[model samples]
Target: MIEVYTDAASKGNPGKSGIGIVIKAGKADVEYSFPIGTYSNHEAEFHAVIKALELCKVQYPKEILSFRTDSKIVVDTVEKNYTKNNNFLPLLERIQELSGHFPLFFIKWIPEKQNQRADRLAKEGIHK
Candidate 1:
């Protein structure tokens, strides 16, 4: 299974934002960081997952995927397969659609300390 760690950050609640992702498959690993324009922190978090999944679909098609994130809200939203918040409906739908391409997909929530690498990359992206 391919393992992926992702994170996102916004300079302000709805200010400059960025996304970071780290993908590990066997002995190989890759990292990505990019600016995501202005969005809320939560929105950025969702986008990070979307970006990571998009990359995975292209690079590791038909493979099982295990994704880790620091955002509990994202994890819960994905796990439950539903979200009551209307603003997140589209984002959640996109995630669900991306996940369907993989034979198996799992999303886990880790503490902030455990997700430092992706967090740092996300912070760096904010200035780009």
Candidate 2:
């Protein structure tokens, strides 16, 4: 099993943004921070998940994916447990489509403090 922790942020609702991801496989931990340009935080969150999935394809193609994120918009939308506002529909659809590629997937919402590493990456992404 592989655990990927992800997070994203925007300076404003529709402003500079970034996506961050931390992948853990046994004793190895890898971190990624990507500048996603001007977008809403929700969009950045989706980007983070997409980026994480892409990385997983290279590093753990056959492993079950368990992802943790603190973004309510992302977690709720992916779980199909909540309705998304119109602004997020496109990204939501993309995420739904991406999930089809995985053999097994799980995404859960965790407390922001518990998702520190990814959070740090996201903040770093903002500046880079």
| Model 1 lDDT tens row, 14-118 | 999999999999998898999999999998999999999999999999899999999999999999999998878899999999999999999999999989989
Task: Go through the candidates in order and give the clash count of each.
Answer: 0, 0
Question: In model 1, which regions exceed 4 Å deviation?
Answer: none
Task: Provide the TM-score for each candidate, comma-separated.
Answer: 0.98, 0.91
Which pairs clash (backbone N, Cα, C closer than 3 Å) in model 2? none
- The local lDDT score (0 to 100) that residue 111 gets in candidate 1 is 98
Query: Which ranges in model 2 have alpha carbons more than 4 Å from their true place?
Result: 81-84
In candidate 1, where is summed lDDT lowest over 10 consecutive residues?
80-89
- What clash count does candidate 2 reach? 0
Tens digit of per-residue lDDT, candidate 2, span 31-84 = 999998998888888889988988888788888899999997788888883454
Per-model lDDT: 0.95, 0.88
| Model 2 per-residue lDDT at 5 | 100
Question: Residue 28 in model 2: shift from native, Å?
Answer: 0.4
